[model samples]
Target: MSAVPNQAGSWSTLETPLSEPIMETLGLLGFDAMTPVQAGAIPLFMKNKDVVVEAVTGSGKTLAFVIPIIEKLTRREDPLKKHEIGALIITPTRELAQQIHSVFSTFIDDHPKKDQLTLGLFIGGTTTLAQDITTFNQSCPRILIGTPGRLEELLTRSQKIVNTKELEVLVMDEADRLLDMGFSQQLSRIIAQLPKQRRTGLFSATMTDAISELVRAGLRNPVRIVVKVEDLTSKGSVQRTPASLDINYIVCDPEQKLIQLVRLLQAELNDMEGARKFIVYFATCACVDYFYKLLKQIGDLKPFSLHSLHGQMDTKRRTATYTNFTQLPPAVPAVLLCTDVASRGLDIPDVDYVIQIDPPQDPKAFTHRCGRAARAGRKGKATVFLIRGREETYIEFLKLRKIPLERGYYRLEDGSVCDNVLKNDDAEDEKITTSEVEDASVAPFIATLRAIVKKDRDMHDRGMKAFVSWARAYSKHEASFIFRLKDVDLGRVATGYGLLKVQKCPN
Candidate 1:
């Protein structure tokens, strides 16, 4: 079924000026009308001026920039040449590149009368170098999207396939993140290889002084478009103030944090009516991995699965995981367990929740993570899970922006946990006293062997039935229960799947 626009009744008469294919794609994607960013930036970008667009995440930033570029490129009178990277979109992370690339693919797939043009994506988290390089060298994709380092490496090495001089448009998506991750020098190197006359555009959810200087240096007297004025705060409105997004901060201690998260997800899932997919973020892969497995094993509710996108997995697996999740909406609602690296301007819609399983190392990341949901006039929720010892930095971070956090939680005085207290509505004793450190700093990792059963409820007759078998496989590592991607056999899974001749792994 084609996606229907919310305002289809009068959209055709407004001289909206979208190409017939784009209009159709819009209708197919259910984009009812032009967003504020799209409304302002599209026309300016269609004029081919260098553009710097600053808007919050989930504000339809994708279409704001994408429609104009697509409109300009596909409608061009000249035929695109082979082996030339005509349009380049540079992103900060591999996950984002893959995510945006998937979006473009979907949009183009549904677009009618799309020109027969080669498109290439250069992202990490996948180990398909030969396939990617072949596409790069031979296809000369009209639109080239990639992360900074990989794209740069390919350009410097692939003399046989690339013609940077032929590039007509350059886009730096998430310029702040690219710079934050120390991509400034890499960006500069990549820029030097492109034609100076090419049109340049930079898009970000927020702006810092560093990003401003980047725009001035990269763009030619660029047109600046800030859609934040339409942003709302203290409310869920998507169109007007430092004030469209309502900021909700929940303070809890480490003790009851997991329970709080489970409650949060259940509420979000139930309330959203399963419309939005959630991105549950953690500080480290281990945190994500441990929680994901524990939930799967302990909870009898559903066949919940977890995916880790850290460096532990090779590039190919990581790319495949991201591709699978963002390919299209899930068959049913699902949760994405990821790190901060996956948070940025990947336009996933209908997301109502952004759950920070761990507090972000930096404050700016808070905005980016929250941007996942509550998009385009849609009411979304951003929940941060905080513990006691980390209060000083976390509180100071919020204070920097004048946002007040509310303290609340289920409870903290459980027998097992005492390290991090829970968020308490009772503030008389809000600050966790040092005497509560019984469970240890990393209490969450070492689940009580018996409670693991109590938490999941299905270990014996149902979920993760292979835990004991798999756990037996990793006796050397002394992991209580063993595991594998899926099905490596109990003993072999315990010993680490196939140094000899393994059959299967832990389920």
Candidate 2:
């Protein structure tokens, strides 16, 4: 049912069974020891047994699946036959598919048969179908890495472009994200096209009902390996993201959340030196856009460059942003404001911090989001900003699930939250009253503010000053547009932000 990690074995253990080429490549790649997931899953994978692994992001799950597939391909007597796709690895996002492909390419580069056993990447928007077809026709790559939609599109466009019958291994990376992104239909269609008699490996950051159901249907007698915190809590244990990760949360009014987030970034840059990478997760694209704009204009954030990513951005821009952020030089502060799109499987190096503006709907997502940091045994910190009253339930859920979390605070020069907000005369003075709304002269402006507020269900009155400040900068109308809004309309927007009846009204 499950496999325990074999502590005694390392990559060297495979030296006797695997050809010298694979061993030499592993050595060159500087992979000496086996991650627990690798130790547990690789043995089953090499035995031609199907595997379903529940491991966090950046846990070396990519290589666990890649190495065995490469070894199988290399052991084959004949070179990759015409149009044969020896191994197919399907991921949910183009970035992840590209990342995995890069890793595969590096390993393949060191292989003796690098030219014969090639790797191909197929993702939408990155290349034209005709171009992909030509490349496939010329080399007929033995290893194929791609997202579901692009792979499905290619299959429908060309009948024999991918010889599924010749595929020896089928891998689904981030299987949970695939299901969450509503790719189940596309995944089902792709699976139907794949050969039934093949080794299938499904890997995900968490085990969910959908993943379990897919495992039951897609994999036969799969060896299951689920890595838990307890598995890795012991020093020297190999499992999941390192226990060195620091988890914390800061409770604040919904409106001040973004301001506080900016404060955290300011603190990081002020206190630390050298290259630092930070990922801040928002609940929606609207939140990400607003925060990106706010961060660009506010505070002492000018020194650090900012990048925004969401589902709406075109592939080229998203790729460019990812490249720029990941490759930043030392002493440069790089920050990525994104939705869950970046949370799943992209392995960005040297990420020093991860901040969640709001608690994720699923507790499991918190683990993966934080897993982006503390990678490869490096120390990192993860913080979640919670609205004082609303987030207690989510925090409780996290605690009940046994996810580690610490209470956090901002040590600003002015004062702490307790001294500033809880015990200050200015607290009531800063509260916005609902009756203070100035009706907008134009319907379009009112409508625009309503649309923006509707997208964010977590906004509150405490944040109105910040919103107005952002609105004034955003609309180019200065203070006139904000004053023009009817009190009722602004109140409606505040309600959308999760403002309560008893709270202070907008000023």
Per-residue CA lDDT of candidate 1, range 1-507, in tens?
A: 112233223235434477777777778778777766666666667677788887767666666666666766777677666666668889987767766677677667766535534568888545455667876666557788899987887777666467777677888988888888899988888888888888888888767898888887788888887764322234443432123345554544344455555555555445546434677887655445555555654352253334545545667777677766665454456677776766776655555567786556566777777767766767666677654432424555565554444443332323222233344554444443222333242244224423554454443222232333223332322211221123222332211111122334323
Q: After superposition, how far is residue 80 of candidate 2 from its true place, in Å?
A: 2.0
Ten-residue segment with the worst summed lDDT in candidate 2? Answer: 433-442
After superposing candidate 2, which stretches have Cα over 4 Å from the reference?
6-9, 231-242, 272-275, 414-507
| C-alpha lDDT of all candidate models, in order | 0.60, 0.71
Report how far residue 489 has shifted in candidate 1, in Å: 39
